[model samples]
Target: MRRPAFHTRLRAHASACGGSSLIEVMLAVALVAVSALGLIAAQVWTAREARAMSLRESATWIADSIAEATRTPSVGNAALNQWSAWASVLLPHGDASVGESGAVAAARVTWASVRDRPTAGDGIGPSAEPCGGVDAPAGSSCVALAFAQ
Candidate 1:
């Protein structure tokens, strides 16, 4: 057979060197892997943020439900200190010793999940003695009123 021409030899030589360098190929693969991992991390963070926001909204809605329950006539002995939701109500019982405890002035709120989860001493049961837990000295009859969430 006739020997190959000069042009064919040059073309073959260029082809032998034309493919990707090993280091360059490996670097490209690593870059793509890193970008994929970053996208996954971003997705996870977004899901976590969304879950936290949803929990906060649920807590606020539970509080609103308790307030609305107080407005209903069926809420027995209900007041700002004794409002009841369809599920539960939080009542306060501050130690009369603390004269200016800010906790008494605020509603004693428990998440609905607390009741649903059923912990050791938690449920949709009697919370506290509602009436006599208000701003009274101890037995001054402050109408025994407060509210819950």
Candidate 2:
């Protein structure tokens, strides 16, 4: 057979190497899949964080509302009486605008705090304040507690 030209040999080599080799294609696909999985996990984590943040913020608001409610003699008409002892109480209170569930969660800042002042009327209760309206901030519920010395 006649000797093959250098150009022909190079062409043959290129064809053999052209397109993605099986290993290269597999690696590329795996890399893409891994990146996609990572992105999805990040998104999931962010979503969970957002939910937790909302819950946390709401909890703080509940605490503030308790304090505000306690300052008055008739806060929630005797809902905040339990502030003297560190106790947490959750009730179906607040605006339904957050959801039809129309539920509100109230908890003593802490069991220790609950006993701070024995003098109490009640703890913050549900529907103590209007929430979930344009006038009210989002994800915040205000409640009134009836507390006194």
Candidate 3:
């Protein structure tokens, strides 16, 4: 048989190595899968954060409304009870409490916060701490407001 040219042999060898091996293909797929998972986790975290923020805003609005109502004369228990009931409906695991001593009146609205999510620092329940304050019960978030007549 006649000998093949050196260039032809090199071309054949190059063609043989051109395609990815099974292991390489698997590794590439695995890498892409990992990246996709990370993206999904980030999106979930973002959504959770957004929901938490919305809850916080609602709590603030409720607290403010209660405080404003307290400023009016003869703000009856029925009205306050209605406000609390409305807040409970508007937020998850929501509760509202109002207290009055002398000329000062305070209202607090507490709701369920996402547990096991770190905020600012890695301290346990840090995410709930700001909203819940020291009075936040375990596994709950809170917002409090006060008004003086």
Instruction: Sort the predicted structures by lDDT, highest score first.
Output: 3, 2, 1
How many residue pairs in model 3 have overlapping backbones? 0
lDDT of 3 by residue, 53-84 (tens): 99999999988888877677688566678788
TM-score of candidate 1 versus the correct structure, residues matched by position = 0.44
Per-residue lDDT tens digits for candidate 1, residues 33-56, read: 999999999998788677656644
lDDT of each: 0.44, 0.45, 0.78
Q: Give lDDT for model 1.
A: 0.44
Instruction: Tell me how candidate 3 scores on lDDT.
Output: 0.78
Q: Which ten residues in a row have the lowest lDDT in candidate 1?
A: 91-100
**lDDT tens per residue, model 2, 49-146:** 77655544554555565556544546643544443321233322222111112334333332111112223235534322243222333223333222
The best candidate in terms of TM-score: 3
Residue 131 shift from truth in candidate 1, angstroms: 23
Off by over 4 Å in 3: 1-11, 15-21, 117-134
Q: What TM-score would candidate 3 get against the native?
A: 0.73
Cα TM-score per model: 0.44, 0.47, 0.73
| Comparison by lDDT, 1 against 3, better one | 3
